[model samples]
Target: MFELSGQDVGEAQLLVDGSRLEALRGTRTCARWRWSPGFQAGETEFELRLPDGRTRRARIVTDADTRKLTRDDFDAMVRDILEDTFALFSLSPFRRAVSRGAGGPVPPIARLEFLRTRIGELEQVVARIRRAPRRRLRAEEAVLPWHKARHATGTEIVRSFRSGRVLRENHQPPRLPVQLRGHLPELIRVRRRTDTFDLPEHREMAACLRSWRDWLRAVSGRLSAASLPGSDGAAWAARLQALALRVERMRQEEPFAALPDAPATLTITSLFRNDPTYRDFHRLWRDMNLGIASVFGDFLAMPLSRTFELYELWCYLRLARAVADRWGVEGDGVSSLFGVDGAGLTIASSSLVLSAGGGWRLAFQPRYAEFWTRGDGRGSYSRPMTPDIALWRQVDGVPTPLVVLDAKYRVDQGLADALTSTHTYRDAIVDTKGGVVNSAVAEAYLLTPHQPAAGGQFETLPMPDRLFAPDYHRAFRFGALTLRPGMQAIEVAASLDAIASGLES
Candidate 1:
């Protein structure tokens, strides 16, 4: 993945092999693609087609990591990044179109594949049923004639008929023909019969069980070639295959699904919720679910798009950590001040705010203050001031904006391009009350993925003596922090420490 800053100067665009791709927001050397109409912070993946009929993975956002992470940790990191990034769009002002919809149902195949965890439960149920083969004895009623009665002090008709036969025959009653069937009652009584299989419930259950086995087999075959991490997965698949085979054999002669319930009755959550062996399967399914996003064959790729928002979130979280670490105040009650509002997930300000005790607060993409520019004594206006991260400390029981930081996705040149904007942001944004004007922010800084070009040096802005002390201006006050992969935490913390010290003066 690569990062390019962009601008909408009416004609700014990039051409890849003469195919027109308009820049979302700068020059060809430093521009973000016009992925949508407005500023979008996420990353998008595309296949970089080569002349040799091969394609390589590429992304629109910068890839921050230099090393490969373990699967579980990697998965967790992905989720954390998404959650933190998505949290920004939940800001009250910017809340638009963001939805927490991960809890919804997955596709049937994916669900079935995920259910590999319940194999243990299925096995247990199958073994228990096989051991006893649940059969019931039912009482059936029947009528018998006198000739068929052996131990019958039968009904009056049968007794009278037998006596008449005794008179008509050679002075003796006819002996009953002993042709009684299995478990037949004597002389018109109820018969107890053992019923096995052939029950309606049993047939339905059997069919459902067979369908489940078939589904498992189909899913296993579909994912057979996937090189997912975990040797145990292979063993699990093998076991499932064996189980399917056993199920097939059981279906040949007996109803495996007939043991009280249908296979459809056993869902992944319902049946495997308590099974210890199913935990890994759940994780595996989650992993698989990430691969497919929609019917257009789009996939969720690593270094996932939307790095801008992710970076903003990282800055907020890192700043919170830094403040908590330095001030010994527990950063608590982290939450989105608002929710995603309406269609297309558009955020109003995309601020992620956290409450730090002792009258301290951390915010991301906060649009609380505004800046205005007066040109030649004429009443001129500027756009609203929106900072990526703002740290507020209470002074005289009033929250004062201390340090404001901007998350820039550009490299060194792009960061350079944003220097003028930084000066404007720091100087123009002000607090006004009763015709009295004051600078709302004490200091401003830039956060970026590129390493500092001047070896951790900052650029000093020359300010009027009346506005700020000369000495304060000489220390290269406003600068950018190089946010690399391995050292983000340390870099952010160190930057925050400097910001804190700068605010102290």
Candidate 2:
């Protein structure tokens, strides 16, 4: 909620994000307006319209509570959750699409930063591998003159004796073969130790390096295709081209050139396990294979203004974890959370459904449309309502919405306003049969970072002790749950358990 007042303005209207705000009181020159920014964070624009046809503009920077979680902490949490989500998506059909540039437009700053850092590390590793590549003494067969042959095995000598050719060159002094009176051959087959870099491990390393170079080139091409003139993306694409060129050059040099393609079956040697260079190479190669960073590059590019959306996603994942903890996930439940579309692979943000044991299922942003006149089903009595998270239970072959949780990235007074939606959700959403209407949702709650006694207007609603009390949920199905970043899994589970207990009552 925000308040704006201007001098010498008889009657003024306040607009936030281009939407006019209703004044709470005192409209002339000192009107107080209430507006909930919701999850929007960053610079917010405010425009005030005066009665005299004059306009005043102000920009205010809004941010989350630093005491709860900093921006860096928020970004890290988002990355971690996205990594987990990508891991789950890898098992679904969308994995192939994700590999084929499904991540949409490359985010300039985050993509460039990732490429820069990873390429730097790869350069160092390639240099080290080049300096000391794995090699072995391979026995090589060669035909040499008798005088030059240092060691010849009996089998080789016999083979050379059978296939030996006489040297026609005239020497000042007779060579060893001529002096031996035809017992020694002029040319002999010899076996010598030679350092060869054709080991299976080296082949595997070469394959990994080639894969990296190709992936970098592909990403660079994508950036170039989407880049505009003099844009940051164009600059990033240039930088990526340079990095890709460097990798290509490194891959073409020395041991990599001598190595064959990676075999269908390659053994993992002890050197790969213990050697520093080999271990680093293996680890980095595995990380690149996962494609967690590249596949979800758009996530890291998200702006702070969309922090609320990120928070909502994080909340859903955390809630799913809590639900899984309470009741084990059903078969392939985790993999079912993702779906593939023309946009590539993405979490089913609008209509994801996850099943668990005990006939429980969790849904993400399922809509309850108006179906009041229709027979027995779940829907809203008035307008369509969609909650961020909904918990359902299968009862008599029907999926019944038991709890609805709306994640609001607001605290204190903003949270209080958010709670009003819960009231509407609990009352308007209903189960109808033959024109009979009853509440479809047992409990509806606003999930926020608001803690009791945190010094805000929330004190007027409920204190910490009473708000979190299990009995409180039973008495009032509509309330608020404190869920913020950095909360332990156990703590989140406990908070969710409170909701379950309320439903049981």
Q: Write the per-residue lDDT of candidate 1 for residues 1-505, one digit (tens) a residue.
A: 1244334323433332122355454454454554331221223334333333444544464233322222222233333333333443232244244322222222222222223323443555555555645455665544455356444443433334433223222223444323221122323442446676554434544664565567546535544444254343443355456557765665555544334544333235532455444433343334333322111101112122334444555455556656655564433344343323222232124655666556677776666433334321211125666777777776566667557777765654555666676677777666664466676667777776564322211224321111122243345566666554345456667766666665554
Error of 2 at 289 (Å): 3.4
Q: After superposition, which runs of candidate 2 have C-alpha atoms over 4 Å from their true positions?
A: 1-117, 124-132, 150-183, 249-258, 261-280, 292-343, 355-358, 366-388, 397-505
Instruction: State the lDDT of candidate 2 residue by residue for 1-505, as single tens digits.
Output: 5555567553677876445677775755666778665433444567778777877888887674533334544544564465556645543444354543425545334334434555666778878988988788998788898778777765676677677565554555655455344466678988788998887787777776676666667767887788786465665566667777887787788777866788422356898788999888776565444442434433345544456666777787777777776887777776667655554555554667768777788888887788754455668878999888888777667766569898887765556556678788888888875557788888888787666553333334464434544455656766678887777878988887876774444
Q: Which is the leading candidate under lDDT? A: 2
Best by TM-score: 2
Q: So what's the TM-score on candidate 2?
A: 0.54
* TM-scores for the candidates: 0.40, 0.54
